[model samples]
Target: MGQLSKIEWTEATWNPAVGCTKMSPACQNCYAEAMSHRLKAMGVNGYADGFKLTLLPERLADPMQRKRSTIYFVNPMNDLFHERIPASHIRQVFDVMKKAPQHAFQVLTKRADKGEGFVASYDASHHPYLAL
Candidate 1:
């Protein structure tokens, strides 16, 4: 997760948390998991847990720190709406996105049911750009 990204859909990627369990056959070739293993082997701090559902609180405020406006692919490496992530933590992530409107936060979760439930309860007025 950094200010610059090669992903065509967005300008940058921000991982408030990383790592996820395989949800389906599509996840068999998970680039994130493979990369996390490599990062863990290389001693990169965040991947220490190596594809486990690990949250990085320090990275939460990353977008707010950058002066330039950007399109942030939030949690591109992991499912933010994964069952393992707490409701409060999900709210916290949304809260950060709400506070930083200069940036557009895109969240795509394989857990559509959980994602829908969260969205139904979340105040859309507060987070206009937090697209699920």
Candidate 2:
């Protein structure tokens, strides 16, 4: 899972997983949902469920090897804090971010409560790269 970016804020986008179900009004016209269905039809490997939650462990370490200082938009295709995702996997993602201190990781989540827990679990000094 090499870095490939389309947005201005980040140098690249990485999806450890794809496919996400709508959870709030903000998801009414989710880009991921549309993209997932299209990818599924094209026989892309990760979207078979078409917006159902899925995990991609193969992509977990993507940030560690990037040579440049980058801004990574974590899980732009889905919410990392979704209940369906395991805490252990979330921690792995965090661990990668911690290791890649040269990169800035922006994690946005509609699940605010879960986001709070994520922040509380980490040592602030070790994860200076994470931003809400």
**TM-scores for all predictions:** 0.93, 0.90
Pairs that clash in candidate 1: none
Cα lDDT computed for each candidate against the true fold: 0.86, 0.82
lDDT of 2 at 68: 83
In terms of lDDT, the poorest run of 10 residues in model 2 is 123-132
User: Which RMSD does model 2 reach against the true structure?
Assistant: 1.5
Clashing pairs in 2: none
Q: Candidate 1 residues 33-132, lDDT tens each?
A: 9988998999998988999989988899889887678988889879999889999888888888888878888888889999999988998797644455
User: Which candidate achieves the best TM-score against the true structure?
Assistant: 1
Q: Tell me the TM-score of model 1.
A: 0.93
What C-alpha lDDT, on a 0 to 100 scale, does residue 114 get in candidate 2? 90
